[model samples]
Target: MSEPQYKRILLKISGEALAGEASRGLDFGVIGEVCEVIKECTQMGVQVGIVVGGGNFWRGVKDGAGRMERTRADHMGMMATTLNCLALADVLEQMGVEVRVQTAIEMRAIAEPYIRSRAIRHLEKGRVVIFGCGTGNPFFSTDTAAVLRAAEIDADIILLAKNIDGVYSADPNKDPNAVKYDFISYDDVLAQHLQVMDFTATSLSMDNKIPVLLFALKDPKNILRAVMGEQIGTIVKEEK
Candidate 1:
């Protein structure tokens, strides 16, 4: 019931997370849990904008490895994101949360085209805005799109909901000795070549001075805990 540390946040969710244990397609149960947490954030008067990934359906680089042109493959990946946005929007709406979906690519039949001012207006009006398609360009990951949207909206912070608990010195799954960081500087992340995010996304966040809080999405309440300013994850920002 306390005031959240941030007034507005950009939440980046992995599509594979949405797929739950099946790891292949939409899992409404997991989506429902995530959406329930999102609803709670709205009830707390927090404005939310989301960028959901499309790895569950298609991974441009991995799936398009052989013969598909990179551009076409990425476009397919973008469409996959639209599927996720629509799925999230549907669930949120069913929960009585006003939702709007904006896509980087224009699809008049389904969603509004990405307009910076309009997207901000939607947030201000207490509507959840879901951004789909990765920057409307090929070769750019959804991570970059999330940061780009966060910067455009002037969000206080980005809540990155992933499978891992936080950033590790190395892949914790692969390396037992990998150390977890409660907080880290953007420069260190870059210098050490850590995979907190893709290089472009991390550099963009650093330049924009937008901090990213990375946490496991398994316990969705961690999203609320993060907004309440609890130290539950690895925070990446410029070191003062």
Candidate 2:
């Protein structure tokens, strides 16, 4: 098979991906599996940058305790991402892949603050950098952070490793016959109000002309396949 078209890619993984069938918290086995795939991609000469979400541990809007403010909940969510970042970094390191965790929020002792130049340098040295914290602020999702980081790092494409295999006209789980799009334009996504990512993230990617490939994370090999340009999922890009 021919290699993937991308030389550099940003992979956005939801915190939920780190969880096994349990539906909450970190699962080392799952993380280790993902790390192996990442190691393979790195070995294949593909530069990889990752942005991880904190939904497994926290979601600001979903908190029902009433005592927690939105910003406070979001802050906790950011910290949760740091924990996931550290875990991923450790696992990837054990896999013999150079990895770094950069946070949007200042957690000096645990990670380096998000610096575009430093991230770029790490990528140049063939190190995988995982970005944690959601834009270092509330009112933003990690999806937006992924797009921002991709643009900052000058990534060729954004790989959205989702729970589902690809973008669909409707929620496939709800509607069995929902059509899966093989390829789509960013505009089409926006126009159709598809939920591949949040509108903010989708708009940013469109504005920056970054293509996003959505694929399932259930198959660890999908990561390698994505980097190898296997066309395993929907590709969202600008229209020709």
Candidate 3:
């Protein structure tokens, strides 16, 4: 078997991706397929870390956080992320993948607290580390949390699995003339205001000089392709 392209990677999966075609909540079919793909990545000797969003369950910033106390709403969103991570971890373990969940917040009963050294140790043991609960702070998106975790773990790159195949000049679903970009720079992304991820997340990635690959989560094989460094999606980087 050929060697994998990256030694370690952080996969940022949105809660919406876990929901698949459904309007909301977990989608077992998608979960199974995603786990299968992750299992394949493990076989290739790649240390994987996952950061899941809570959009399906809740979105503090875009949701009713406007009316509610910002901190409380964000805390609720964090709990929602923990729920998603636990479900994913359970499915992954059932699929024969050794998985450990770590949350930014202190949730001793359900998961271990986010310990940088411990997380790296788990990855070294060939275990998948699932990061939940965002950054343990309000007014922060899970995308930023993913990058923060990636920086902490020193991951080689971030795999941003989204609903679309890649970044576009405009929202493809909304615009007919939108064009797809095979690769884009972080500066252009900000200058053009392309909606790939939150500004905070993109800025963090740029500050750390980490690359992010954006791809559709529809086909499970795409996960393997992205991890294997295949040309599957748009690569967001600091340079052209």
Candidate 4:
């Protein structure tokens, strides 16, 4: 087996990945497979932290949030993320991987509040820390949360898992001829306005000098491969 290049990583995946082929909601089978993949990494002595998206259940921007207040809609989305985090954390625990779910909004009954030092300590103890909710505030994307967590935990890299395999000049799904890049700079990503992540998230990553690996999550073992430095996706970094 190839050795892992990274000691610790923050994996940011959309809720859609957990949904599998379904339009919405969690897919137990798919998530179970994900849990096993993550378990493989922990055994390799890699510390893992994760940020789950809420797209499968709710998105604050959906319907322009329609009639609801912006903050309320955003709160709903944050709650949805907590649901995903809880589900993922439960599965990881079942797989014998020590897991801790931290919520930004302080849901003491279900999860511990997001404390940077505590989360880092968990990772140091070989526990996977699952971050839910978006920085305990409205309007911040989970993408931003992922970057923030990576910075706080001093992670080596951020695995930005998506439905597609890598970063492209245009939407790969819609534009067949769109060019894919094996590597791209964070500055270039921002300048081109690539939708790889929200601007706040991308900027945060750039400023912190965190390497962001954009890859497909459909393959169950991609996470392990990524940590092993398999070059299975596009790597984004700061050139300067």
lDDT against the true structure, per candidate, is 0.95, 0.90, 0.92, 0.91
Q: Cα deviation in Å at residue 67, candidate 2?
A: 4.3
Model 2 clash pairs are 4-228, 4-229
> Better model by lDDT, 3 or 4?
3
Off by over 4 Å in 3: none
Name the best candidate (by lDDT).
Answer: 1
Ranking by TM-score: 1, 3, 4, 2
Tens-place lDDT digits, model 4, residues 26-124: 999999998999999999999999999999999887834668898988999999999999999899988899999999998899999999899989999
Each prediction's RMSD over C-alphas, in Å, is 0.7, 1.3, 1.0, 1.2
- Who is ahead in TM-score, 1 or 2? 1
Candidate 2 lDDT over 159-227, as tens digits, reads 999889999999988999999999999999999999999999999999999999999999989988888
TM-score of each: 0.99, 0.96, 0.97, 0.97
Candidate 4 weakest lDDT stretch, 10 residues: 59-68
Supply candidate 4's per-residue lDDT for 19.
92
- For 205-234, candidate 1 gives per-residue lDDT tens digits of 999999999999999889999989999989
After superposition, which runs of candidate 2 have C-alpha atoms over 4 Å from their true positions? 64-67
Worst 10 residues of 1 by lDDT: 58-67
